[model samples]
Each structure stands twice: as C-alpha cells, then as structure tokens.
Target: MPHMFTISPDFPPNSLAGWYIFNTWFQKNTGLNIHLNLYNSFEEQTIAIDNNKNDIVYVNPVDAVRLVRDKGFLPIARVKNRLDEVVIAVSEENPISMMCGLKPDLKLAMTANPDVNMISMMLLEAVDLNNSNVVKTTYDSYIIVVKNILKGEADAGLFLAKAYDDLSNVVKKQLKILLRSDVEELYHSLLIGPELADRQDEIQTLLVSMTDNPVGKGVLEALDFEGWLKIENEEMEFMIDLIDTLVPDTD
Candidate 1:
C-alpha cells in the first residue's frame, strides 16, 4: 500500500496544489508511492495523525510538539519561510496603543486554531489581562480576521506578521499593530510517523535535496518557499517550552 502524506490547511486550497506536483516527482525519484491528503482544519489533521492513518504530515510548531511528544512522530525537515511572530492589530482609528488598552470586555478575533489561540492567550496574559475577558470570534483565515476587524465586527485581531505584510496597501493603511509578539524562530515541519520510521533517512534526504531538481524547484516556487532544511530536535525545544508555560499540563 502507498504511504499517506497529509498537509494542514493553514493556507488556501489553490496554493496546496503544488504538493501534488511535488508528490509526483517524489514518487518518481524515490520510488515511494505516497498519497496526498489535505485537511481543512487542524482538528481533523490532528485526529488523522493520532489515529496512525497518516505516514507523513506537514504541521506547524504547536502540532509538531504534540505529534512528537505524544504520537511518536519525528520531525525531519522544515519550510524555510516559516512563521516567526504574530501581531495584535486594530483599526488605525482605534485608540488602543497596547494590549493593556483593551477594554475589560474584549472582542477579539483570531484564527480558529489551537496554536494561534494559545499565542493570543499568552499575549493577553503578558499584559496582565485575564484571558477570560476575551470574547473570541474565530475565523478560518488571517485575512478574514483582518476583514472582521475592518468591518467593525471585532475590536482587535491576532494574525501572523507575514500575513499582515501580505495585506494590500489600502488595507494596511487601516490597520495598526498594537503589539508584536516576541520572536520565536520556528518553522512548519515535515514529520514522519512511526509507520515510516524505517524510511526516515531516505525521505529526509529527498526533501532536503528537492530544491536542487528542476521540477522540485518549480514546485517550491509554487509553494512559496525557498527550500526545506533538516531540523534538529533542539531547534523546537523553545516552542515546546513556550507552549507548556502558556498552557500548563498540555500533553
């Protein structure tokens, strides 16, 4: 049976088609028949990984920690242009200058994902605000979170710095970042499940060497990444620790 490779849908569906092209080239070069599965939500993806239904997965730093610690998945490689920091943004017209400026009954907007929610909570805590005061309005994507704030449906929103940079200039003019989270240099990782342990080295080599091939280079371009880099366990320790500190007793 072919191995299953799944991706978290942190990005748009159109962008994810690059994985199909990469998978084709990967199968040809490595002689490994890997099927591609794209998940629309973090919850679905995590469930699949936990059920041992996926042989390989592309996950963010938070999910990477959970899979590694609880599911026995090994992180092999990471996207070169991974997210590093998140921004707390509000309308330029709003007078909120810092997180402390938020009213006791805060109407916050953020992506409906565990990692982002945790980061938002941590940022709130940093300013000595009770997270319980936050009335969260979840959006499927960062762009929507920004839109919700622009539409006056949300008082503030949290989104990745990169996503904020990618916003249109007109939209940029309307929003101002009140606070920038401390930089946590982290990457979206490619993890190998226990079922694929025997082929870990081979798979890692293929991914790390992808940029060298013409087809792989094209796929990388489509995926908006420079290349993949081999990752060390120690590189993710900070993220794990941050999560633990923010959310106590998280397994």
Candidate 2:
C-alpha cells in the first residue's frame, strides 16, 4: 500500500454521502490511498489544512486565497461544482435602508463558514462596521439561520445559493433580497496543497480524465462536479483581487 493521502472535505462527515463516494473514487484513480478528516465547521477545516493535518484540501475561494498567499500553497484545480452564493435579505415589512440607518445596532445573521468572510467583507464595505448598527449572530448551518430569520429571531440573514433556492417560496412571501454577490466566472472552488504544486499537470490530467474511468466518474458525480480544468495564472490573479478588495484592514 502506498502512502495514504488525506483530504479535508468541504462537506461534513458523510453529510452528502457523495463526498465519501468521491473520496473512494479519487483514491482508486490516483493509486494513492485516500482518507477523509471530517470537519463540522469551516474554521476547523481551515485550521486542519494550515496545520498540515490534511493534504489536497478543498476550500472555498476566500480560504483558497488565504492558503495560497499566507501559506505559499498552490491550487491544482477548482471544484467544477460552484454552489457558493451570498444573500443579503431583510423582512418584507422592514425597509432595506433600516440597517444602515440604525448604525452598529442592527441585528444580522450569517452562515458560520469561514468562507463567509468574503460576504462579510462585502457588507462591511457597503456600511462601516464601526459606524453603523451591526450585531451579528452565527449558526453552524445555513438552514438554521434561515429558520431564525423566518421565525423572527433574526432581522436578516445571509445564505448560500442552494439554500436560497430551497427557500424560494418563503423568501418570496416574507423576505426581500437587499444584495447579491457577483457571479464567480472562473470560480473553481480549488483543489490544493503546498506539497503538490509541482505536480499540477499530473493532477489536472487525472481529474479531467477521471470521468472516463468508472470509479473516477462516480467520485465526480458524488462531488457534484463535471470535471476539473487547468487553472490559468490569470484566474489566480482574479482571486487575489477579490481578496484585496474584500479582506478588512484588521491586519
């Protein structure tokens, strides 16, 4: 048996069933025994990658930029499945400008994913976090956050695109969208590791051709990915801009 490489999945332990299917698929396809270090939170996943507890990790674009710049890592490819979205919503009766008018006193809820940092930065840019009324509450899952807003526990909520689609009926009836993020054009969710930078060609080939193999095909489908593509340097440059434009001056 060769060295067993590890991947920190984007999804929690077996939460999507397909994640494990893809894990097995990639392991068999690459001839590298693969294992998953399950994570319940994005913070945990980011820390695991930062500490070298996982290899060839999957991360959202925000975290991806952080890993590459802060850790001198490289991305082999981005996930073909791009489900991340940022939603800014308010209750129907409340005017959209109410939060800004209130200044640091308005209540907001957001998904607890570290990648959500990008969304938060956008909102802060629109309104000063210090000058405006902004109180934040976090939930482990986006669905819970949606529920909180629906039940009047929260004044507004930010959620992923899939969650927004799932809650379409309720959103239309009771909530209003204040803002939506820009579409990710070259947004490959990113497959990366510091150690694999030199093997970019091989990794990209394996991922793109995996579909031709039965096991590889299964993993691709499980991950909700069509296939991986070679990332251009320009794509990475775009990510850099997104980060610079988004990251706060807390440094």
Candidate with the greatest lDDT versus the true structure: 1
Error (Å) of candidate 1 at residue 162 is 2.9
What would the per-residue lDDT of candidate 1 be over residues 17-46, giving only the tens digit for each residue? Answer: 778887787788778789998776666777
Q: Tell me the spans in candidate 1 whose CA falls farther than 4 Å from its real position.
A: 12-14, 236-242, 249-251
RMSD list, candidates in order: 2.6, 3.8
Cα miss at 144, model 2 (Å)? 1.8
**Per-residue lDDT value at 92 in model 1:** 92
User: If scored against the real structure, what TM-score would every candidate get?
Assistant: 0.87, 0.78
CA shift at 114, candidate 2, in angstroms? 3.8
Q: Which stretches of candidate 2 lie over 4 Å from their true place?
A: 1-15, 81-83, 91-104, 120-132, 166-176, 183-188, 211-215
Q: Write the per-residue lDDT of candidate 2 for residues 105-151, one digit (tens) a residue.
A: 65777766554545654665566753134677877766667677778
lDDT (0-100) at residue 235 of candidate 1?
Answer: 67
TM-score for candidate 1, residues paired by index = 0.87
Q: lDDT value for candidate 1?
A: 0.77
